[model samples]
Target: MSKTIESIFKPHLKPKEVYQGGKNPPTSNGKKIYKLSSNENPLGQSPKATEALLKAAKHIDVYPDQTDIRLREALVKDFDGQLNANQFICGNSGSEIIDMLLRAFVNEGDEVIYSNPCFLPYAVFSRWYGAKQVDVPLLNTTYDLDLEGILNAVTDKTKIIFLTSPNNPTGTYIPKSVLDDFFTRIPKDIVIVFDEVYRHFADAEDYISGLPYVTEGHNVVAVNSFSKTYGLAGQRIGYCYTTQTIANYVRQIHKPFLLPITSIEAAIGALNDTDFIAETVKTVQVGRKYLTAEFDKLGIKYWPTQGNFFIIDPPLPEFEFTDMLMEQGIMVRPVSQFGAPGKVRITIGTQEANEALVKALKK
Candidate 1:
């Protein structure tokens, strides 16, 4: 007998909530529209990256290097050779690499653990892969990850743990000492995926990246992207650092030439543009401080952030507050779907944009 469409697919497959990224606000009174919703680099892409991208455009007829040798080599130099090229796996974006990691490690009925309010992809992909998800809520008072709760949630069926530093929306980060203790307690067999796309913005002295754990040969993967820091969101390029064993496994599943040659060249050029990186970081840090001070004066409550954005407990409902901002020709994120209802996430923008946001809030 012929099979029906539903019969061909796995029974466990079910629809999940799609990610709702920041959107452009409606035009208002011919005023300048400042999109502070997406946490994008307001200064734009680096000059060096644009130059390299244009140069690589001439070779559009040829496929990119399947091995990603040149790009990986650039990464090696960027990290001062602490991680070998073979340990890196380039992807269309850090998001894609994360999906690949889930595909590589998770199987039907296996459990995946993560904080309740996290980068949505973790829950979405876990469900897609037929893995049971364990949602550990963040600490109520501080909106910080409940590491002790996560450790207690673990079981033999657990396959992976997703950790996001300077966590999205809330923007809280796990301190080095906290993470060190957490690492010692976690089972070495379970793969830990650390998303640190915002590490460059986390200037706190106690914050740390998962690179050290990776170097220690623990079952850890550090995922990073050029999107946030290098203004390469349009390029859709990112990479991960992990043990050679896991890298090989993920590479085996990844199709060849998944990244465009131009994107690869752009990332390499961005890595070389250290001056631009420093400038972007400084701009974000300054803007963050300015916004924080303004919020304090206004008696607004918000979590202390280590990323380019922070979640605010606004006077009105989250959507209401966001709509109010939109009417003023400003765009910001309403993160109820990320599990923080009645709160909004605002990205730190340029000095002009920051001033405009403050002006709107004061009115």
Candidate 2:
């Protein structure tokens, strides 16, 4: 009998689909391509961060602090007592912390709850651990979490609940009132993981991060990434805030020396560069409005957004519309994989890039 690699792997691994990130714009036509596919900062990395990274290169020979103490302290200081350094679990990225949370809390036969058409990683992590997934459908049209539905779905088997503010692809968020109610009703034993990766972009009056709940000593953890506001996606640095108990458990499962020295230095610099953060947020806010106005003029249907990207229900199929845009040297994300059919996500780029995207959509 011939032995196969698949035979040695876990049975569930065979059916697991790989995630497809946004593609790099095609340069075959030699046209100037404006990449608004990935939700990246159009202004690029913080200049202060860049300088810090370059300076930190001199110490490449040494290992990074295994615990990321300085970054954790900075986070606590930023939050003004909402969290403490001991309540943190710094990781290579927010996604990494998500994975760690699942590994630490979820077990085979346990159920994990999340909204459909949300961040894909939540479902992926649950599946990887052989856990049952309970996906509640979003409220129709608005794409907000069906809080009542999620509450009803809870069972004794449910171990974790994942919520995202300014949720990926759709850009909608859970209001503070809803969160307050949900926290009150949910089981205290069940862990709540709030993915607030785009928290910086959210300006809605009702939006709330998981930090306050964490402050109140709820079983909640809020994940944040430097990738968005700091323009440090390439650095792959992020952190989470939870109770000291949960934080200690997560740190046990996390790899040692997880963050590179340069990444840590860059993130610290990014945190300190208030001017760069202000400009980046302003640019995204302006671009978001510009895109919305332009889409309105073109009679395109788009979801209202609180993040750096928004979804558009195009006249044609999403992939078809994306291809049409690509022909004009523009790139945007198709959301079919995210379970939002007939929709595409357009990242808020610079004024020039946003205008070009609008012009292409018009064509």
Any runs in candidate 1 off by more than 4 Å, and if so which? 1-3, 25-30
Give a tens-digit lDDT track for model 1, residues 210-237.
8898888888899999999999999999
Stretches of candidate 2 off by over 4 Å are 1-8
Model 1 residue 282 CA deviation in Å? 0.3
Relative to the unseen true structure, what is the C-alpha lDDT of residue 189 in candidate 1, on a scale of 0 to 100? 86
Superposed Cα deviation of residue 352, candidate 2 (Å): 1.0
Q: Where is the poorest 10-residue window by lDDT in model 1?
A: 20-29
**Candidate with the greatest TM-score versus the true structure:** 1
In terms of lDDT, the poorest run of 10 residues in model 2 is 10-19
Q: In each prediction, how many residue pairs overlap at the backbone (N, C-alpha, C within less than 3 A)?
A: 0, 0
Candidate 2, residues 42-143, lDDT tens digits: the string is 899999999999999999999888768898888777777667788987888888888999999988889999887877888887888888989898987789
